[model samples]
Target: MQAAADQGVEAIRILGVKLINPGDFFELLLRFLFNLIVTVVIIRFLYYPHSRRKDYFFIYMIFSVVVFLVCYSLASVSLQLGFALGLFAIFGILRYRTDTIPIKEMTYLFLMVGISVINSLTDKSVSYAELLFTNLVIIAVTWYLEKIWMQKKEDFMDIRYEKIELILPERRADLIQDIKKRTGLNVYRVSIDRINFMRDTAKIRIFYRQDSNVGPISKEAPKQTPPVDS
Candidate 1:
Protein backbone atom coordinates (compact mmCIF):
# COMPACT_ATOMS: atom_id res chain seq x y z
CA MET A 1 0.00 0.00 0.00
CA GLN A 2 2.86 2.34 0.81
CA ALA A 3 4.46 1.74 -2.58
CA ALA A 4 1.12 2.22 -4.32
CA ALA A 5 0.45 5.41 -2.38
CA ASP A 6 3.85 6.82 -3.32
CA GLN A 7 3.26 6.03 -7.01
CA GLY A 8 -0.14 7.68 -6.84
CA VAL A 9 1.37 10.82 -5.37
CA GLU A 10 4.09 10.99 -8.04
CA ALA A 11 1.80 10.21 -10.99
CA ILE A 12 -0.66 13.01 -10.41
CA ARG A 13 2.16 15.57 -10.14
CA ILE A 14 1.89 18.37 -12.72
CA LEU A 15 5.18 20.15 -11.95
CA GLY A 16 8.42 18.86 -10.45
CA VAL A 17 10.98 20.41 -8.22
CA LYS A 18 14.61 19.38 -8.63
CA LEU A 19 14.93 17.86 -5.14
CA ILE A 20 11.34 16.77 -4.75
CA ASN A 21 11.94 13.15 -5.73
CA PRO A 22 14.48 11.48 -3.51
CA GLY A 23 14.28 8.35 -5.58
CA ASP A 24 14.91 10.32 -8.73
CA PHE A 25 17.71 12.18 -7.03
CA PHE A 26 19.39 8.94 -6.00
CA GLU A 27 18.95 7.62 -9.51
CA LEU A 28 20.66 10.69 -10.85
CA LEU A 29 23.55 10.09 -8.47
CA LEU A 30 23.88 6.51 -9.59
CA ARG A 31 23.53 7.43 -13.25
CA PHE A 32 26.19 10.11 -12.93
CA LEU A 33 28.61 7.63 -11.37
CA PHE A 34 27.75 4.94 -13.91
CA ASN A 35 28.34 7.33 -16.77
CA LEU A 36 31.60 8.40 -15.23
CA ILE A 37 32.77 4.82 -14.95
CA VAL A 38 31.79 3.96 -18.51
CA THR A 39 33.29 7.17 -19.86
CA VAL A 40 36.53 6.58 -17.99
CA VAL A 41 36.74 3.04 -19.29
CA ILE A 42 36.30 4.28 -22.85
CA ILE A 43 38.68 7.19 -22.57
CA ARG A 44 41.35 5.48 -20.55
CA PHE A 45 41.41 2.23 -22.46
CA LEU A 46 40.37 3.15 -25.98
CA TYR A 47 40.86 6.85 -26.80
CA TYR A 48 43.80 7.69 -24.56
CA PRO A 49 45.94 5.17 -26.40
CA HIS A 50 45.34 7.31 -29.50
CA SER A 51 45.07 11.02 -28.61
CA ARG A 52 46.31 11.10 -24.96
CA ARG A 53 44.75 14.38 -24.02
CA LYS A 54 44.30 14.96 -20.27
CA ASP A 55 42.26 18.11 -20.75
CA TYR A 56 39.66 16.28 -22.77
CA PHE A 57 39.43 13.68 -20.02
CA PHE A 58 38.36 16.35 -17.56
CA ILE A 59 35.97 17.94 -20.01
CA TYR A 60 34.17 14.70 -20.85
CA MET A 61 33.43 13.88 -17.22
CA ILE A 62 32.08 17.34 -16.46
CA PHE A 63 30.18 17.58 -19.71
CA SER A 64 28.43 14.26 -19.16
CA VAL A 65 27.32 15.25 -15.67
CA VAL A 66 25.88 18.57 -16.83
CA VAL A 67 24.00 16.98 -19.72
CA PHE A 68 22.55 14.33 -17.40
CA LEU A 69 21.24 16.99 -15.03
CA VAL A 70 19.60 18.93 -17.82
CA CYS A 71 17.81 15.84 -19.10
CA TYR A 72 16.71 14.74 -15.64
CA SER A 73 15.23 18.15 -14.85
CA LEU A 74 13.29 18.36 -18.10
CA ALA A 75 12.01 14.78 -18.03
CA SER A 76 9.02 15.69 -15.95
CA VAL A 77 7.66 18.34 -18.32
CA SER A 78 4.66 17.45 -20.51
CA LEU A 79 6.41 18.48 -23.70
CA GLN A 80 9.47 16.25 -23.14
CA LEU A 81 10.04 15.46 -26.79
CA GLY A 82 10.30 19.11 -27.68
CA PHE A 83 12.51 19.78 -24.67
CA ALA A 84 14.86 16.94 -25.57
CA LEU A 85 15.17 18.11 -29.15
CA GLY A 86 15.80 21.63 -27.92
CA LEU A 87 18.60 20.36 -25.70
CA PHE A 88 20.43 18.73 -28.61
CA ALA A 89 19.85 21.75 -30.83
CA ILE A 90 22.00 23.78 -28.46
CA PHE A 91 24.91 21.35 -28.86
CA GLY A 92 24.84 21.89 -32.63
CA ILE A 93 25.83 25.52 -32.08
CA LEU A 94 28.98 24.29 -30.31
CA ARG A 95 30.48 23.37 -33.68
CA TYR A 96 30.79 26.94 -34.98
CA ARG A 97 33.40 27.92 -32.40
CA THR A 98 36.86 28.96 -33.63
CA ASP A 99 38.44 25.66 -32.64
CA THR A 100 36.31 23.05 -34.32
CA ILE A 101 35.33 19.92 -32.41
CA PRO A 102 36.95 16.72 -33.61
CA ILE A 103 34.69 14.01 -35.00
CA LYS A 104 35.62 11.58 -32.22
CA GLU A 105 34.91 13.94 -29.35
CA MET A 106 31.71 15.11 -30.99
CA THR A 107 30.58 11.50 -31.30
CA TYR A 108 31.26 10.92 -27.59
CA LEU A 109 29.32 14.06 -26.76
CA PHE A 110 26.32 12.74 -28.65
CA LEU A 111 26.60 9.42 -26.90
CA MET A 112 26.73 11.05 -23.48
CA VAL A 113 23.76 13.24 -24.34
CA GLY A 114 21.79 10.26 -25.58
CA ILE A 115 22.59 8.30 -22.41
CA SER A 116 21.48 11.24 -20.30
CA VAL A 117 18.15 11.46 -22.11
CA ILE A 118 17.56 7.77 -21.71
CA ASN A 119 18.52 7.65 -18.05
CA SER A 120 16.44 10.60 -16.95
CA LEU A 121 13.11 10.25 -18.68
CA THR A 122 10.48 8.23 -16.84
CA ASP A 123 7.94 6.45 -19.01
CA LYS A 124 5.48 3.57 -18.58
CA SER A 125 6.43 2.03 -21.90
CA VAL A 126 10.07 1.74 -20.83
CA SER A 127 10.67 0.12 -17.50
CA TYR A 128 13.77 0.49 -15.32
CA ALA A 129 15.08 -2.83 -16.63
CA GLU A 130 14.83 -1.57 -20.21
CA LEU A 131 16.68 1.59 -19.32
CA LEU A 132 19.44 -0.35 -17.60
CA PHE A 133 19.72 -2.60 -20.58
CA THR A 134 19.83 0.34 -22.95
CA ASN A 135 22.69 1.94 -21.06
CA LEU A 136 24.60 -1.32 -20.96
CA VAL A 137 24.07 -1.88 -24.67
CA ILE A 138 25.48 1.56 -25.49
CA ILE A 139 28.52 0.92 -23.34
CA ALA A 140 29.06 -2.48 -24.90
CA VAL A 141 28.75 -1.14 -28.45
CA THR A 142 31.10 1.74 -27.77
CA TRP A 143 33.65 -0.63 -26.27
CA TYR A 144 33.49 -2.88 -29.29
CA LEU A 145 33.63 -0.12 -31.88
CA GLU A 146 36.45 1.72 -30.20
CA LYS A 147 38.47 -1.24 -29.02
CA ILE A 148 37.80 -4.27 -31.18
CA TRP A 149 36.09 -3.55 -34.50
CA MET A 150 37.81 -0.41 -35.82
CA GLN A 151 41.52 -0.67 -35.43
CA LYS A 152 42.50 2.52 -37.22
CA LYS A 153 41.30 5.84 -38.58
CA GLU A 154 42.82 8.35 -40.92
CA ASP A 155 44.93 10.92 -39.15
CA PHE A 156 44.54 14.66 -39.80
CA MET A 157 46.40 17.84 -39.03
CA ASP A 158 45.70 21.58 -39.13
CA ILE A 159 48.63 23.43 -40.62
CA ARG A 160 49.36 27.02 -41.36
CA TYR A 161 50.37 26.01 -44.88
CA GLU A 162 52.03 28.64 -47.02
CA LYS A 163 52.93 27.02 -50.32
CA ILE A 164 50.54 28.61 -52.78
CA GLU A 165 52.58 27.50 -55.79
CA LEU A 166 52.64 23.84 -54.83
CA ILE A 167 48.93 23.87 -53.99
CA LEU A 168 48.01 24.57 -57.63
CA PRO A 169 46.51 21.72 -59.69
CA GLU A 170 49.59 21.39 -61.91
CA ARG A 171 51.85 20.93 -58.87
CA ARG A 172 49.85 18.38 -56.83
CA ALA A 173 52.70 15.89 -56.73
CA ASP A 174 55.14 18.62 -55.87
CA LEU A 175 52.88 19.65 -52.97
CA ILE A 176 52.78 16.12 -51.57
CA GLN A 177 56.52 15.74 -51.98
CA ASP A 178 57.23 19.07 -50.36
CA ILE A 179 54.91 18.38 -47.42
CA LYS A 180 56.38 14.91 -46.92
CA LYS A 181 59.90 16.29 -46.99
CA ARG A 182 59.17 19.06 -44.50
CA THR A 183 56.76 17.44 -42.02
CA GLY A 184 57.39 13.75 -42.79
CA LEU A 185 53.65 13.05 -42.88
CA ASN A 186 52.14 10.67 -45.43
CA VAL A 187 49.64 13.29 -46.43
CA TYR A 188 46.88 11.70 -48.52
CA ARG A 189 44.78 14.84 -48.99
CA VAL A 190 44.86 18.59 -48.35
CA SER A 191 42.03 20.98 -47.56
CA ILE A 192 42.36 24.71 -47.91
CA ASP A 193 41.33 26.55 -44.75
CA ARG A 194 42.27 30.04 -45.87
CA ILE A 195 44.05 31.62 -48.84
CA ASN A 196 45.99 34.86 -48.85
CA PHE A 197 47.55 35.40 -52.22
CA MET A 198 48.87 38.74 -50.98
CA ARG A 199 50.87 37.07 -48.21
CA ASP A 200 51.58 33.95 -50.21
CA THR A 201 50.02 31.92 -47.37
CA ALA A 202 47.20 29.40 -47.24
CA LYS A 203 45.89 27.58 -44.16
CA ILE A 204 45.98 23.87 -44.95
CA ARG A 205 44.23 20.92 -43.42
CA ILE A 206 46.20 17.80 -44.18
CA PHE A 207 44.75 14.33 -44.00
CA TYR A 208 47.07 11.39 -43.75
CA ARG A 209 47.24 7.77 -42.68
CA GLN A 210 47.29 6.97 -38.94
CA ASP A 211 50.99 6.17 -39.15
CA SER A 212 51.76 9.83 -39.82
CA ASN A 213 53.92 11.33 -37.05
CA VAL A 214 52.11 14.66 -36.97
CA GLY A 215 49.63 15.02 -34.12
CA PRO A 216 46.51 17.14 -34.74
CA ILE A 217 48.29 20.30 -33.62
CA SER A 218 52.05 20.16 -34.00
CA LYS A 219 53.57 23.37 -32.67
CA GLU A 220 56.95 22.85 -34.32
CA ALA A 221 57.07 24.59 -37.69
CA PRO A 222 57.94 22.45 -40.66
CA LYS A 223 61.59 22.73 -41.65
CA GLN A 224 62.03 24.65 -44.89
CA THR A 225 63.35 22.36 -47.60
CA PRO A 226 64.75 23.18 -51.02
CA PRO A 227 61.94 23.57 -53.55
CA VAL A 228 61.15 20.26 -55.24
CA ASP A 229 62.00 20.29 -58.94
CA SER A 230 58.76 20.40 -60.97
Candidate 2:
Protein backbone atom coordinates (compact mmCIF):
# COMPACT_ATOMS: atom_id res chain seq x y z
CA MET A 1 0.00 0.00 0.00
CA GLN A 2 2.84 2.43 0.82
CA ALA A 3 4.56 1.72 -2.55
CA ALA A 4 1.27 2.11 -4.38
CA ALA A 5 0.62 5.49 -2.68
CA ASP A 6 4.11 6.72 -3.61
CA GLN A 7 3.58 5.80 -7.26
CA GLY A 8 0.21 7.52 -7.32
CA VAL A 9 1.72 10.69 -5.89
CA GLU A 10 4.53 10.60 -8.42
CA ALA A 11 2.04 10.19 -11.26
CA ILE A 12 0.05 13.17 -10.05
CA ARG A 13 3.18 15.30 -9.86
CA ILE A 14 4.27 14.28 -13.36
CA LEU A 15 0.81 15.01 -14.71
CA GLY A 16 0.81 18.44 -13.00
CA VAL A 17 -2.55 17.70 -11.39
CA LYS A 18 -3.82 20.14 -8.78
CA LEU A 19 -5.12 17.30 -6.53
CA ILE A 20 -1.65 16.38 -5.27
CA ASN A 21 0.68 19.21 -6.38
CA PRO A 22 -0.43 22.00 -4.12
CA GLY A 23 2.66 24.04 -4.94
CA ASP A 24 1.92 24.11 -8.66
CA PHE A 25 -1.70 24.91 -7.96
CA PHE A 26 -0.73 27.75 -5.65
CA GLU A 27 1.69 29.14 -8.19
CA LEU A 28 -1.01 29.14 -10.89
CA LEU A 29 -3.49 30.80 -8.55
CA LEU A 30 -0.99 33.48 -7.55
CA ARG A 31 0.04 34.28 -11.10
CA PHE A 32 -3.56 34.35 -12.30
CA LEU A 33 -4.55 36.70 -9.47
CA PHE A 34 -1.66 39.01 -10.21
CA ASN A 35 -2.41 39.01 -13.94
CA LEU A 36 -6.07 39.82 -13.28
CA ILE A 37 -5.19 42.75 -11.05
CA VAL A 38 -2.81 44.20 -13.59
CA THR A 39 -5.39 43.83 -16.35
CA VAL A 40 -8.01 45.65 -14.27
CA VAL A 41 -5.68 48.53 -13.47
CA ILE A 42 -4.77 48.96 -17.11
CA ILE A 43 -8.31 48.70 -18.44
CA ARG A 44 -10.24 50.56 -15.72
CA PHE A 45 -7.82 53.37 -14.91
CA LEU A 46 -5.54 53.75 -17.89
CA TYR A 47 -7.78 52.94 -20.87
CA TYR A 48 -11.52 53.23 -20.06
CA PRO A 49 -11.50 56.75 -18.62
CA HIS A 50 -10.20 58.15 -21.90
CA SER A 51 -12.01 56.09 -24.53
CA ARG A 52 -15.15 55.00 -22.65
CA ARG A 53 -15.83 52.19 -25.10
CA LYS A 54 -17.48 49.35 -23.19
CA ASP A 55 -17.18 46.82 -26.02
CA TYR A 56 -13.40 46.96 -26.20
CA PHE A 57 -13.22 46.98 -22.41
CA PHE A 58 -15.09 43.69 -22.32
CA ILE A 59 -12.93 42.27 -25.10
CA TYR A 60 -9.64 43.13 -23.38
CA MET A 61 -10.62 41.65 -20.02
CA ILE A 62 -11.98 38.39 -21.43
CA PHE A 63 -9.10 38.05 -23.86
CA SER A 64 -6.57 38.51 -21.06
CA VAL A 65 -8.08 35.74 -18.96
CA VAL A 66 -8.28 33.26 -21.82
CA VAL A 67 -4.78 34.03 -23.11
CA PHE A 68 -3.21 33.79 -19.67
CA LEU A 69 -4.72 30.37 -18.98
CA VAL A 70 -3.88 29.00 -22.41
CA CYS A 71 -0.29 30.22 -22.29
CA TYR A 72 0.21 28.99 -18.71
CA SER A 73 -1.00 25.57 -19.75
CA LEU A 74 1.48 25.52 -22.61
CA ALA A 75 4.40 26.91 -20.57
CA SER A 76 5.89 23.46 -20.04
CA VAL A 77 6.90 23.30 -23.70
CA SER A 78 10.41 24.29 -24.83
CA LEU A 79 9.19 26.15 -27.95
CA GLN A 80 8.46 29.39 -26.14
CA LEU A 81 9.75 31.61 -28.95
CA GLY A 82 7.68 30.07 -31.74
CA PHE A 83 4.60 29.78 -29.54
CA ALA A 84 4.83 33.40 -28.46
CA LEU A 85 5.25 34.57 -32.04
CA GLY A 86 2.25 32.55 -33.18
CA LEU A 87 0.13 33.97 -30.41
CA PHE A 88 1.06 37.49 -31.45
CA ALA A 89 0.17 36.74 -35.04
CA ILE A 90 -3.24 35.37 -34.05
CA PHE A 91 -4.09 38.50 -32.08
CA GLY A 92 -2.76 40.87 -34.73
CA ILE A 93 -5.27 39.80 -37.35
CA LEU A 94 -8.52 40.10 -35.38
CA ARG A 95 -11.13 42.23 -37.17
CA TYR A 96 -14.75 43.29 -36.99
CA ARG A 97 -16.83 44.00 -40.08
CA THR A 98 -19.22 46.56 -38.66
CA ASP A 99 -16.59 48.79 -37.12
CA THR A 100 -12.88 48.38 -37.54
CA ILE A 101 -11.11 48.92 -34.25
CA PRO A 102 -9.22 52.18 -34.04
CA ILE A 103 -5.46 52.20 -33.72
CA LYS A 104 -5.65 53.32 -30.09
CA GLU A 105 -7.93 50.45 -29.10
CA MET A 106 -5.81 47.99 -31.03
CA THR A 107 -2.75 49.26 -29.17
CA TYR A 108 -4.38 48.60 -25.80
CA LEU A 109 -5.41 45.13 -26.94
CA PHE A 110 -1.84 44.43 -28.02
CA LEU A 111 -0.53 45.56 -24.65
CA MET A 112 -2.97 43.34 -22.77
CA VAL A 113 -1.99 40.31 -24.85
CA GLY A 114 1.71 40.97 -24.36
CA ILE A 115 1.28 41.33 -20.61
CA SER A 116 -0.71 38.09 -20.36
CA VAL A 117 1.89 36.19 -22.40
CA ILE A 118 4.79 37.46 -20.34
CA ASN A 119 3.11 36.74 -17.01
CA SER A 120 2.13 33.19 -17.95
CA LEU A 121 5.05 31.83 -19.99
CA THR A 122 8.05 32.68 -17.83
CA ASP A 123 10.40 29.72 -17.29
CA LYS A 124 12.57 28.98 -14.26
CA SER A 125 15.24 31.30 -15.61
CA VAL A 126 12.94 34.27 -14.91
CA SER A 127 12.09 35.38 -11.38
CA TYR A 128 8.78 36.63 -9.97
CA ALA A 129 10.38 40.00 -9.30
CA GLU A 130 11.27 40.37 -12.98
CA LEU A 131 7.79 39.40 -14.14
CA LEU A 132 6.24 41.99 -11.80
CA PHE A 133 8.64 44.72 -12.93
CA THR A 134 7.75 44.16 -16.58
CA ASN A 135 4.01 44.51 -15.93
CA LEU A 136 4.61 47.61 -13.78
CA VAL A 137 6.65 49.26 -16.51
CA ILE A 138 3.85 48.75 -19.06
CA ILE A 139 1.24 50.15 -16.66
CA ALA A 140 3.43 53.14 -15.75
CA VAL A 141 4.08 54.09 -19.36
CA THR A 142 0.38 53.77 -20.31
CA TRP A 143 -0.72 55.86 -17.31
CA TYR A 144 1.82 58.56 -18.07
CA LEU A 145 0.73 58.86 -21.70
CA GLU A 146 -3.03 58.70 -21.09
CA LYS A 147 -3.17 60.90 -18.00
CA ILE A 148 -0.15 63.19 -17.69
CA TRP A 149 1.38 63.90 -21.07
CA MET A 150 -1.71 64.11 -23.27
CA GLN A 151 -3.99 66.81 -21.90
CA LYS A 152 -5.98 67.50 -25.04
CA LYS A 153 -8.49 64.96 -26.33
CA GLU A 154 -9.86 65.06 -29.84
CA ASP A 155 -13.49 64.10 -30.40
CA PHE A 156 -15.84 64.11 -33.37
CA MET A 157 -19.55 64.25 -34.20
CA ASP A 158 -21.62 63.56 -37.30
CA ILE A 159 -24.29 66.05 -38.27
CA ARG A 160 -26.69 66.44 -41.18
CA TYR A 161 -26.17 69.89 -42.67
CA GLU A 162 -28.97 71.25 -44.85
CA LYS A 163 -26.81 73.84 -46.54
CA ILE A 164 -25.08 71.78 -49.17
CA GLU A 165 -23.93 74.97 -50.92
CA LEU A 166 -21.92 75.99 -47.86
CA ILE A 167 -19.83 72.82 -48.21
CA LEU A 168 -18.16 74.25 -51.33
CA PRO A 169 -14.47 75.22 -51.23
CA GLU A 170 -15.16 78.95 -51.49
CA ARG A 171 -17.71 78.89 -48.64
CA ARG A 172 -15.54 76.83 -46.24
CA ALA A 173 -15.21 79.63 -43.64
CA ASP A 174 -18.95 80.31 -43.76
CA LEU A 175 -19.63 76.59 -43.28
CA ILE A 176 -17.42 76.43 -40.19
CA GLN A 177 -19.05 79.55 -38.72
CA ASP A 178 -22.53 78.15 -39.32
CA ILE A 179 -21.62 74.77 -37.76
CA LYS A 180 -20.13 76.46 -34.65
CA LYS A 181 -23.19 78.70 -34.19
CA ARG A 182 -25.55 75.73 -34.51
CA THR A 183 -23.59 73.06 -32.58
CA GLY A 184 -21.87 75.17 -29.86
CA LEU A 185 -18.71 73.11 -30.45
CA ASN A 186 -15.23 74.58 -30.94
CA VAL A 187 -15.07 73.11 -34.43
CA TYR A 188 -11.56 73.14 -35.88
CA ARG A 189 -12.10 71.10 -39.05
CA VAL A 190 -14.84 69.33 -41.00
CA SER A 191 -15.16 66.41 -43.41
CA ILE A 192 -18.02 65.67 -45.77
CA ASP A 193 -18.97 62.04 -45.33
CA ARG A 194 -21.92 61.89 -47.73
CA ILE A 195 -24.15 64.22 -49.72
CA ASN A 196 -27.87 63.60 -50.19
CA PHE A 197 -28.98 65.55 -53.20
CA MET A 198 -32.64 64.57 -52.93
CA ARG A 199 -32.97 66.08 -49.46
CA ASP A 200 -30.40 68.82 -50.10
CA THR A 201 -28.51 67.70 -46.96
CA ALA A 202 -24.96 66.55 -46.48
CA LYS A 203 -23.46 64.39 -43.74
CA ILE A 204 -20.63 66.24 -42.05
CA ARG A 205 -18.16 65.08 -39.45
CA ILE A 206 -16.65 67.77 -37.23
CA PHE A 207 -13.49 67.54 -35.13
CA TYR A 208 -12.77 69.51 -31.97
CA ARG A 209 -10.18 69.53 -29.21
CA GLN A 210 -11.20 69.77 -25.59
CA ASP A 211 -9.67 69.30 -22.16
CA SER A 212 -9.81 65.77 -20.76
CA ASN A 213 -12.01 66.75 -17.84
CA VAL A 214 -14.68 68.20 -20.13
CA GLY A 215 -17.38 65.81 -21.21
CA PRO A 216 -18.00 65.27 -24.93
CA ILE A 217 -20.69 67.34 -26.54
CA SER A 218 -23.75 65.69 -27.96
CA LYS A 219 -24.85 65.67 -31.62
CA GLU A 220 -26.99 68.66 -30.69
CA ALA A 221 -26.19 71.03 -27.85
CA PRO A 222 -28.94 71.51 -25.28
CA LYS A 223 -30.54 74.80 -24.33
CA GLN A 224 -29.22 76.43 -21.13
CA THR A 225 -31.60 77.41 -18.35
CA PRO A 226 -32.23 81.03 -17.31
CA PRO A 227 -29.78 82.63 -14.86
CA VAL A 228 -32.53 82.87 -12.20
CA ASP A 229 -32.18 79.11 -11.58
CA SER A 230 -28.79 79.80 -9.99
TM-score (all chains, Cα) for each model: 0.58, 0.64
lDDT of 2: 0.86
Sliding window of 10 residues with minimal summed lDDT for model 2: 13-22
Q: Mark the regions of model 2 whose C-alpha exceeds 4 Å error after superposition.
A: 1-19, 96-98, 155-208, 213-230
Predicted candidate 1 versus true structure: per-residue lDDT over 118-174, tens digit per residue: 666656688767777877788788878876665544767777777788888778888
Per-candidate clashes come to 0, 0
* Residue-by-residue lDDT tens digits, candidate 2, 90-190: 76665543467777888888888899999999977999989989999999999898887777778899888999999998898999999989877788899
Clashing residue pairs in candidate 1, if any? none
Candidate lDDT (C-alpha), each: 0.73, 0.86
TM-score of 2: 0.64
Candidate maximizing lDDT: 2
